[model samples]
Target: MTHPICRACGTQYAEPRDDCPVCLDERQYVAPGGQRWTSLKELQAEGHSGRFEEQGPDVFGIGVTPEFSIGQRALLLRTPAGNVLWDCVPYLDDEMVRRVEELGGIDHIAISHPHFYSVMVEWAHAFDAPVHLHEADREWVGRPDPALQFWSGRTKPLTDELTLINPGVHFPGSTVLHSSAGDGALFTGDVVNVGPDPRWVSIMYSFPNHVPEQPQKVRAAADLLAGYRFERIYGAWWGRVVTSGGEEVLARSVERYLRFERGE
Candidate 1:
């Protein structure tokens, strides 16, 4: 009686379905062969394991060993209040649970958007932590649970130092975690992509489907983020971090995107 998980996006469902609504949407695409499904047990049996690596003084990146669905790394922000789990992965095992517990268990779990909402309910239940998700994207939730908490507004503060900022770029509820730790860092889960240049980040409506966001939407997202002071920006993947000057980089990137969109 294992819940079915989408192989492409890693979203768990209350029951088995022919296709994952998230993947079938315009933002994402089903595989060429069609929709596929897998279970956590099946993934674990195939040798998928989760591991955490220190990215900064109190920030760690948690990801699967063999790279599970979507292949996005979850960020662990450790603070005096407690640890916050940002985003999630598909596969979770005893080893990963024990390791996270050793690091002082997750106090809260927050997802940036529906695309990164992979097995979040399971994670919350494991740590007895509350899951925070934006109300705008509540329909995208696959597995409903009592631990899920839906929020609205442009920003929601988790702790005095950490806040969830919704820029509304990729999705209506696209969110990023802003932390005052380590000269200020933004944990953006593909809402603001850390471009290859490392000095800039780009916003997109869809990464997989090659959909671009409107110029005004991009500008608005940037303007919303301008209110915050962040020195570094961390994206969902490994090695996708802007080491410094995140604010300037984001502004420049927005301008660049707008310029290109206008054929300037």
Candidate 2:
């Protein structure tokens, strides 16, 4: 049986449900027309195909054409260790799998937050890789699977050069992957949102509701990330990458956010 995928958020549940908990949350919203559901097979039949683009050096952006659900593209990080899939989309097919396999199949899968948790299990099964998620947001997972592995802590090391840091900005378990490739790059799936300007990043409790994250929380996140040196910030969507000065961009963004929060 096909799992029910949310038409709004793209999260696939183990079975059919009346509502999508992800969309019902404050960070997201249920469609004005109300909740609708679809399956991966249905999406494939509807002509939805894979979209792949080079986001940066050694970083390939993977997304869906015609933009399904949240429309956040996943990044295939090609490190010397292997390819790492940062974040996930709701749709996947045999062709997409074959293309990735040709480029060196995925070694591991990591998601930045709950919003990007769309059909992660499906992807894991396809690649036969482990899905690393923060234990804090375990409740939000729509589909429980044996392949899903939960980690607890402020940070977890995936490789000598790659580490998963939980800044706890957008969600309690919200994460960002710091890669020591080239100069360095931070893979943030809307956890540290890359602004439209491409040079600025922002922190938000809920983008859909226009809610600002707490100043202290933002400050703490920035402080924790200050240790790393990243020249680029990769956001969730296509073309939302900060090509250079990622570390400075994050520092300035936090200062700006806190300054405004203090009403200064």
Candidate 3:
């Protein structure tokens, strides 16, 4: 709990440092007010509590009430195989642990990118679950731990019904999960961001800096996902979800993005 966590990115470092590399990266920004630091113990004392809401059938969106750090919500995907956590938040306590355990607990954890890797080791320890992260982004990991398991390649099947696919977009190892729930669903954590229009989605190299993703990379993501069957797309936020036509939405989104990028 005392480990120094970046206030801008919510990344908990193994040791204290004057700066957070994740924030300083072009993909993210150091807070305008300047870099600040906090710890889980401090957040608990500040009365930051967990917020849980059903984003889909059994997918619960979890985050801190005061929206700490990047303010992205992690998803508790209760798949038929087992309960897998899609991402992680910075704040966690006994209550959050107890609450999650009551919901069948977490069997595995998979993060989309480095920005959302906040206190993941904490969550993994709480539930005795292993974390699956892409190896390409290993250098960005704030705190290395045995609980973190790295995989390299385009896809790794977690269960009979779920698979992790790297789109190679926002981050070199940016991952998205496909679940055979209902018509199927893709759990993306800002890797393939669900846009304001639920029917559409977007990809970016640096969302904070408005940097466009490479046209080839975006096209490759869509091509890779074209093989899956999904109706819903679950984004990384509280309400950012595409309820239906997940496959078509992704295809169209990439086509439009490429066309626009080419000034067609």
Instruction: Give candidate 3 misplaced runs (Cα > 4 Å).
Output: none
Q: In angstroms, give how far residue 47 of model 1 lies from its true place.
A: 0.9
Each candidate: RMSD to true structure?
0.9, 0.7, 0.9
List where candidate 2 sits over 4 angstroms from the true fold: none
Per-residue lDDT tens digits for candidate 1, residues 184-225, read 988898999987789878888889878899888888988899
Model 1 clashing residue pairs (backbone): none
RMSD of 1: 0.9
Ranking by lDDT: 2, 3, 1
Give lDDT tens digits, candidate 2, residues 1-264.
Answer: 889999999999999989999998989999999999999999999999999999998889999998889788999998898889999999999999998998898999999999999999999999999999999999999999999999999999999889999998899999999998679989998989998997689999998889999888898999999999999999999899998888999998888888887888
TM-score of each: 0.98, 0.99, 0.98
Report the C-alpha displacement of residue 88, candidate 3, in angstroms: 0.7
Ranking by TM-score: 2, 3, 1
Residue 60 alpha-carbon offset, candidate 2, angstroms: 0.4
The alpha-carbon lDDT assigned to residue 171 of candidate 1 equals 94
Cα lDDT, model 3, residue 193: 96
